[model samples]
Target chain A: SLSTSAASESDADELQKEQQARSVLRENFLRCLLSAASKNVQFNMYEKVKMEAKFGACDIDVLNFQVSDLHTPIGVQKEALIRSQDVISFTFEI
Target chain B: MEGGWPLLGPLQWVRYVKKQVKVKVGRNEEVRGWLFTVDPVSASMVLVDFMESEGTLVQVVMGHAVEEVQVLKEPDRKIADRLQSMFLPPRTSILDP
Candidate 1:
């Protein structure tokens, strides 16, 4: 019984540690996103496509980015939603 | 790295924070910067690159596009402090009476 209780205690400890790490990571990430708002961002997409847009907000799920003045090859879109799946990476100056 | 990257979970991802990393994205692109944070939900990585000029560059690599991540170097105290305060709001200073 003592051994079983100790095991359970360790499991709870591990869970708590994991939760703390998750929260820290998430908070920093959210802050990063907040700082990125309104900055000019360059997006690297699939098929060697590179474009720039005014950084907007991203959905909670990180599925879509709401951008403005999206520069496509043909022309610029005043407003656009770029799916996260189509993007490889993006950069912005801070 | 590879398919297991997104599944590395929070604990594993946290280990990479404050370290300089070289991340391989897509087929051939590589990015190098200080590891800021990794979104647990989406597994996206935020990297900060200090430039010669005053401003810094921030790069966000989507989770699904990551091919490999290599730890290049660990941060010293100064760098760690810089990374911690990079996105933080400026704190008010206390006045001496």
Candidate 2:
């Protein structure tokens, strides 16, 4: 059906947007983390960022960004899985 | 609503542009339609448009009769609060100025 095709296309678009937004959020998070680390802020973090895009009633998909870090990269990569909330929701629809 | 002036300290209130704040500048006789653009500047505000009597353009500082800011919408506060929390490091020092 045409509506189905359109829905598929929209879904694809949403995924693309989500990834892009997530990348940006990750970039910013990394920048801050690096900046703070460079300044020696006493936090030794090594974790991953999770970005989820959820559509609202107004067709706006809010990017929910969650960031977590550990003292060692190996901790997140292979040891354990945990996430913290310096998270923020960014609305990307207009 | 917050974080823009040196008074507000070093904080990123605006990710792109400074906030638009509605304000009534001047005393009883010297007031009219005025829209204020607030940023971290020595000047109180940059007047965008004023639909009132013609007078020499002047700065609007709190001491110079600028009224207390009134946040019109909750979104304004939400955005401001978000910006505030985003930049707050876990251990900000008292030596920071």
Candidate 3:
């Protein structure tokens, strides 16, 4: 009984540590996203598709990004929503 | 590896913080930078690269597209401090009248 209780207690501590780490990482990431707002960002998508747009905001699920003046291969779109799955990475200056 | 990066939990993801890593996204896409932070919810990684003439450059590699991530090297104290300050505001100075 003692060993079982000790093991469960250690498990709880590990879970707490993991949660703290997640919160810190998520906070810093949110801060980075906030700084990216209003800045110009270049998105590199699949199939060699690259475009630049004014960084706006991403949805809560991080599934789509709302951008303005999206530069595409054909022409510049006034507004667009970029699916996160289509994008591999995005670059911007801080 | 169980859907690659997205499967890595917070404890494992935190190990890459402050270290230099090379991330492979899709075909022919490889990026190297300091591991600033990884979003646990989205599993995206925020990378920072510093340049002399130019300012710091930030890159966010999506979690779904990450093919592989390899730790290249570890950052020194100075480099870690620089990485942490990139998005933070400048500290206020105390006034002595």
Best candidate (score: lDDT): 1
lDDT (10s digit) by residue, model 3, range A1-94: 9999999999999999999999989988988988899999999999899999999999867899999999998999999999999999999997
What lDDT tens digits, residue by residue, belong to model 3 across residues B14-84?
89999999998888679999999998988999999987888789999999888889999999989987876
lDDT to native, each model = 0.93, 0.31, 0.89
The candidate that wins on DockQ is 1
Q: Give the C-alpha lDDT of model 3.
A: 0.89
Residue-wise C-alpha lDDT for candidate 2, range A23-78, written one tens digit per residue: 54333333322332212111111233333222211101212212233234234322
- Clashes per candidate, residues 3 or more apart or on different chains: 0, 1, 0
DockQ of predictions, in order shown: 0.95, 0.01, 0.87
Error of 3 at A27 (Å): 0.5
Deviation (Å) of B21 in candidate 2: 24
- 2 versus 3: better DockQ goes to: 3
- The segments of candidate 2 whose C-alpha lies over 4 angstroms from its true place after superposition are A43-94, B1-97
| Best-to-worst ranking by DockQ | 1, 3, 2
Sorted into a CAPRI-style docking class, model 2 comes out as: incorrect
In model 2, chain B matches the true chain B with a TM-score of 0.30
Worst 10 residues of 2 chain A by lDDT: A85-94
lDDT tens digits, residue span B25-72, model 2: 333222221222222322133222222575223222221234443333
Candidate 3 positional error at B78, Å: 0.8
Candidate 1: docking tier: high
